[model samples]
Target chain A: MTEERRPFVSARTVAERAGVSRSAVSRTFTDGASVSEETRRKVLEAAGELGYHVNHLARGLRERSNIVCLVVADMTTPIRARLIDVLTRKLQAAGKVTMVINTGTDEQSVASAMRQTLNYRADATVFLSGTPSAKLIETSLANGQQVVLINRDDPLTGCHNLGVDNEMAGREAFFLLRRAGCTRLALVTSTAHTASLIERERVFVAVAEAAGLPVAVMAAGPTTYASGYESARRLFGRSDGPDGVFCVTDLLALGFMDAARHEFGLTLPDQLCLVGFDDIEEGAWESYKLTTFAQPFAEMGDHVVDLLAAPVPVIPGRRIFQPVPIWRKSIRASAL
Target chain B: MTEERRPFVSARTVAERAGVSRSAVSRTFTDGASVSEETRRKVLEAAGELGYHVNHLARGLRERSNIVCLVVADMTTPIRARLIDVLTRKLQAAGKVTMVINTGTDEQSVASAMRQTLNYRADATVFLSGTPSAKLIETSLANGQQVVLINRDDPLTGCHNLGVDNEMAGREAFFLLRRAGCTRLALVTSTAHTASLIERERVFVAVAEAAGLPVAVMAAGPTTYASGYESARRLFGRSDGPDGVFCVTDLLALGFMDAARHEFGLTLPDQLCLVGFDDIEEGAWESYKLTTFAQPFAEMGDHVVDLLAAPVPVIPGRRIFQPVPIWRKSIRASAL
Candidate 1:
């Protein structure tokens, strides 16, 4: 770990090798800095030979580091993985490097992630998952870091909020199932109870009960495919099982569909109808054809980058996006 | 964009507020640095009030950045996403931050990503996808950055190479299909001629042809589900379609299976047999149940971190890992 283990080639070495001034070598590497084309070529060639690279860490200390931190958890999950991909690509195109702080689902991890975001002095910190304390958010704001929260309902000040319209999507799911003549309704969710999941479950249950329908709910485990499969086993083991189901996520829906078809011998849309949230790519496979709501990842990614690239700190406020429904064979066509 | 927009709190502010020397504030934040307990407590409280965050960028300029760059493409793919998830979690546990450079399958993007890795002076760079030129590798090595290439066969010096035994897996897949009494065999791959996919296709075709079995090869599009579905459609459209198919990836196999069952009305094992590479989580879903080879992500992640954490730079060499076969129900039990 000693500094002498690896000797860093400096601009002085490149300048000496190219027979140019140190300022000429620096100008060649710095964007928008003026240097004659002939001198730039010579400097670059020398730098290539000497393995001299402009130190962005030093530059970042003098100015704003074009680094964006994504605080996330369960990054292997379909939806979260897609989110990170879109965000990182979009941010890179906007001249920002993404530093992912994987905060496992725990309060201590969330705090540690926030601390890392501050330690790096990133230009912005995007909370893709896990809720940070208000105190942490305030500290980040005071350190001049722009904060953005995704799919979270917390009303922390001085931070931009972006979320999907889960309530609307959930209500629509209930109406879609009921219109298809489904009498027995059930909701399959997970123990995570994230803000988006809670919102979806609440609206679906409220709408169903308001229409004088009893809705069964199951949250046996975390939001994963296996949990959904277990929930299906428990729910459909009875003679009077639900005819229609609403799953909080596409992964859960796929698992539920598999268990119902293979174990319970129920055919989709004929013996049982299903709808899911988050139109993950898996749901669109020929095997599933799951009818669900699409979270606009591309649009959300663009919006987040725009907020970060703004010249001045834009007024902090919530930006709610509507999730569009994708019609597929998982639900009865009559419901459409 | 102006500096006046957000005022960053400094250690001086905390020191002034706590009536302590500026060095005391620094000592309190620096890990393992000594300060009186009373001064440490007072400094922390004052720092919390003033929101002072130590800048790692400045510290990085003096020594190592503790940043590991992951140059990758197609990060949203199941196996790649899982790889990143495992690598990031392990690296973070070892006190390193991950910087993902998303190099879209293009030469220019790959070159740009390499330049960024050098600019940041990352302690190590792991190439997860898209091969880099030998000239780039040489430059990185000269610049004192440890480099690791995954699933590549390039004989570049001064860089560590890690890859799966794709040849063995492909050979085993052919024998498994043959033992299951599948006379006609096919290999389903993608247009993206990555080293792993090419190796898998090569060994499978060579083994089958050596056994006097003619093999059909179809690489319709990119390595995706849609391409797999299209491959299956074209393969099974003929009257004498292959009964056993070996897909280069699980995603393609799943698509092929769905198309065979739904489009061609073929039953599993009875009418068709399948094997695939990369035992992604989705392959084990109740629907697909794909028999495939596991990439050993956790072990590889651990190895990458261990290489980076070495006090002295370890000698650069190649490390080949064997892919373990996962026997799922996609193949007939008679193959056992």
Candidate 2:
């Protein structure tokens, strides 16, 4: 549908003017294809005179448009920045030119992003770490463009969803802290809630209650370094502060660790235990040595590309990946 | 030249079919222009029937192109990531769609990026950090595109250059550490050198030598957290370890601080005083409270836009910003 609309100059016109066969013109343009210099020169001269420009989109007109749109909201976040770089490299290696759109997670911004995608006539769109409005997804599906949502669990029909198992990760974190001999457990999160963070917190609380362990919850202003630091002070201000804490994100966990050590002078693992999710690169720094659940970035990139290459009319499908626990020095060594 | 090559639909054709003046057709497309509803309806109908797609470039063929190309080499660096985000927002607000080209500092990649800028017929191009090859800059200048380089000091003729005053920043950092009663000093930097880091290091060495204070320099790998941690250990391995240290970047400083405290059991400010460049957010955490220099991101973004909007044949200009020192708990509190 997108390709047929472009104005193109047929190769036949160049061949006729150059006084050569159509196959000869193709040979001239094809790399490593044998074509006499004289014939190639004539074809090139004629094509240039006729203003014949190559339409890369026309070659894949029947099956694909060779263009992918990457939609992301926050590029400053460490994980999102890493994902964008990796995904862009992978898509470029696959011979697809990526068109990135930075949009807020609001309904109006998502609608605008969808309009931009339609204007570019993209063959596929990847929503990275934000819930795009359902209407936009349906509209994209209706236009024959595949839509893949990352780190989201939307049940929209005809869309592909991929995310880490946040519930299972939360349960594992609780058990690990408990086994490490932490009696008082707490959870820290930000106000600008993402679905994945919400799920991680909800499941963690549920598991602690099921085990009959008391829990405390603290809400930070935003998932930023400053917010986490301030929230940690508030948590430690209590007379009976929790000994074990799980932060919904690594940025928050880093803040909590710093405050616990520098401000409160608490000994880690011996006096307190910490766990974080989305194991960013900074988490492994010798200072933090944060124990976190590592999300599979390489696998996610491959899955997105594979889904796009699949035949159209893809039914709504869900693929969940188990998060791997990366134990470092943040938690005490424990045997199950 | 690019506009002449594109297939365009003239307003004359729409005017003739709608039986209206060509000026009326122009007024219909112009925003907030007073055109009768009946005439607008007729003009739009004629345009739709004739398949007339509005060419924004054609409208400004004599002056500017609505496209701006942003060429960056490193996307993972926190400061660069923040700059890209802020620049994109500012460009979008000014009604220009940015075309981002991620390239390496190598000659081949830089040349390829220049070709892409020419293909898009961008009005201007902004180089974030890496030094663009001289040939590419000259070629872009010849093609009538304005070129701006950030964090660079190359005397490239007819190219605008903007950077922070690294010499002054380095000198100030040296004095601040000295006032904290530090007798021995050291500087930590990465192997993958940038011009800004080089300038900072050069100035610090010059100042210390003039003050008759010996300085030690340690090089790290890639300026990552791990590299900083390793470099700190190497600095401590010697019996003559320095009491004060300055890292060329904030990321490295964070790592060094963490290692000094967590691994070496050294108390900050009492055992060692630290300063960093590019005051990143993580530096302000309660654990680090690093004293560092802050780059002016918002001002730089505005300056780039202003330079691009300047009249062509713009005489090359140089703009330098002063780096502000943000003091925190990383150093001893001073009345001054």
Candidate 1 collision pairs: A311-B1
lDDT of 1 at B188: 98
Q: Please write out the lDDT profile of model 1 over residues B138-219, one tens digit for every residue.
A: 7887778889998877778888999998889989999999999999999999999888899899999999999999999998
Q: Rate the local accuracy (lDDT) of all candidates.
A: 0.90, 0.78
Candidate 1 lDDT by residue in tens digits, A1-336? 334556568888899999999999889988899999999999999987787888888788778899999998988899998999999999999999999988786788999998898888898899988888898888888778889999998778779999999889989999999988899999999998688899999999999999999999999899899999999999998779999999999999999999999999999899899999889999999889999999999999999989998877777899999999999998888997
Clash pairs (backbone) in predicted model 2: none
**Which residue runs does candidate 1 get wrong by more than 4 Å?**
A1-4, A18-21, A30-45, B1-3, B11-42
Tell me chain A's TM-score in each of the predictions: 0.95, 0.86
Candidate 2 interface RMSD value: 8.6
Best-matching candidate per lDDT: 1
TM-score of chain A, model number 1:
0.95
Which residue ranges in model 2 land beyond 4 Å of their true spot? A1-36, A39-67, A309-316, B1-35, B39-65, B309-315
